[model samples]
Structures are given as C-alpha cells and as structure tokens.
Target: MSGSSKVKDGVSGLEFKISQISKNPPSLLVTLKNNNPSLPFTILKWNTPLDPQATNLGLFKLVDEETGKEIPMDGLKVNRLIPPSKEDLVTVAPGTEEAHEIVMNKPWLPEKRPASYNVTVSGKFSGVWEKYGDDLQASDLEAYLDSPFSGKSFTSNEVSMRVE
Candidate 1:
C-alpha cells in the first residue's frame, strides 16, 4: 500500500509506502518532503520512525482491519537531553525529500497470521523548542528546533495490508 499526505503546517508531504506486504517482514518506506522554498526543513530525528526506540512506538499506529482493534507496539523508551544535539536532527533541503526505511517485524505485527492491518503515523514534525533554551550553543541545536515545524502534529495517510 502507498499513500501521501497533503501540504499542512509548512510541510510539503509525508509519503508512506509498504513494499511486499505478503513477505514475512515488509519494508516500510517513509519520506518527508520539504515545502520551504529556501530554508531547509530541519526536525528532530527522534520524531520519525528512523528512531523507533526513542519514539517508543509513538510514530506509528497499527490497527487490525477485521477486529478494528489497535495493535500494540513495544519499543525502548529513551531518555534524551533537554536540548538535542545536531546529530539528533534530520535536515531536508528545500524542495527536496528525506526517506527512511523501517522493517516491520514482530514488534509491529500481530501474532496471528492471515489477518489484515491498517497503519498510520502521527506525531509532531519537530520538538517543542519553545520549552527549551539554548543550553547547548556549540551544537546549534536551538536554531533547528526553533522553526515553524516545531511542535506541529501531523498524521500520515493510512495504508492497509493483508498478511497471509
């Protein structure tokens, strides 16, 4: 399944695609496109699926199609610093896109087979910089956090798949 979100909150698009769902472990491709014409779109890497452990399954939501019940996800809950470092952010150039791949394994899939599931991701595009000060001036983390994308929640288009 493949889907994309419309422009919202200065974000161009959030594209989601599942390749070979029938496979034991499907590949989930998520791309974030920058709408800014000049400035590069910078956001916390922990906000994306790329850092599932940090997000603690907060990035993706999976529901059983038949039962209409939400599938539970488990991940490591990371304790981060007040001001994130430069390496903790992802920068998408203006008019460009950044893509990340996630392998859907047992943690993301239902135990029972031959079932269908719908998946969607929802979270803030960036961290809440307003609550944080420029404590780490050397990292220049405050600059990236203090953006229009900060603290803006977005939900991606839902994609469905059948597992045999």
Candidate 2:
C-alpha cells in the first residue's frame, strides 16, 4: 500500500510506500520519502523515517484480516536513554527517501496458518524549527506543536499481503 502525508497547508510532507521485496522468507520493503522541497525531515536514529517513539521500536505492524487482530511482536526492546548528537537524528533531504526491509514470518502472526494481512505505517513528524537552535527545550517545542494547525502524527494506508 502507498500513501502521502501533508502538513498544515502542505508546509512539508511524507510519503509511505510498501512492496514485497523477498520471496523465500517473505519480506516487505517499506520506503518513506521526504516531500518537502527544501526542508529536511528528521527522524530518530536507527529507526524508520516515520517512527514516533523517541526510542527505536521498529516501524512496522501486521494485522490479521479475518479476526482483526494485531500480531504480537516478540523480542522487542525499548531504549530508555536518548543520546544527543547529529548521528542520533536522521535527515531525509527534499526528494530523498529511506527504505527498511521487514521479514514476514509465522512467529509474528496471530495464527500459524497462512492468511491475509494488512500492513500499516505510523509515526510523528518532528518539527524542523527545533533544528535551528542549539539549546532546544522540550517545553518550547511542545507549546509550538500544541498550536491549532500542528501536523504531528501520521498513519499510512493499509496495504494487503497474503502469506502462504
């Protein structure tokens, strides 16, 4: 499935695209593209372009079509500490994109039998203004995001995939 997210009045944007990239061990290619003409999209380091968590949670989800249940992800760990550095942040320049490979396996499914599933992408769009100042404060940024026209969270269109 594919979809694009736009900020208030299209100040900036993000595009999500997914496709099957592997066959043996089924996998999905998740691509996130920056749609802003000049401003760069910032994301947490080691995470997908649309990951909203300050910590890395792996940016993907699978849902069973029959029972409408989410597949429980095992061995997922949450990082409690956040380091400050340029490397801690990933910038997607205008017209650029980042891709992630997600392997599809039975362990991630609610049931062992093969079935149809829907994929969804979700995350937050960090404010670009935060990058301008050296001494950034969360309180100040929070106030700005609290504005009436803020565009912070986004969810992509559901794309269907069948596994045997």
Backbone clashes in model 1, listed as residue pairs: none
Model 1: weakest 10-residue lDDT segment is 127-136
Error of 1 at 65 (Å): 1.7
lDDT winner among the candidates?
1
TM-score of each: 0.72, 0.62
Candidate 2 per-residue lDDT, tens place, 1-164, comes to 35444343423466667776665466677676777677655554333433333113544567888879887654356553433344444456778887766666545454444677787756544344423233445553445444232355555556777776
Best prediction by TM-score: 1
Predicted candidate 1 versus true structure: per-residue lDDT over 64-160, tens digit per residue: 8998999877655667776667667665666677777666665556678777778777666565222123233544565556654566666667777
Residue 44 accuracy (lDDT) in model 1: 70
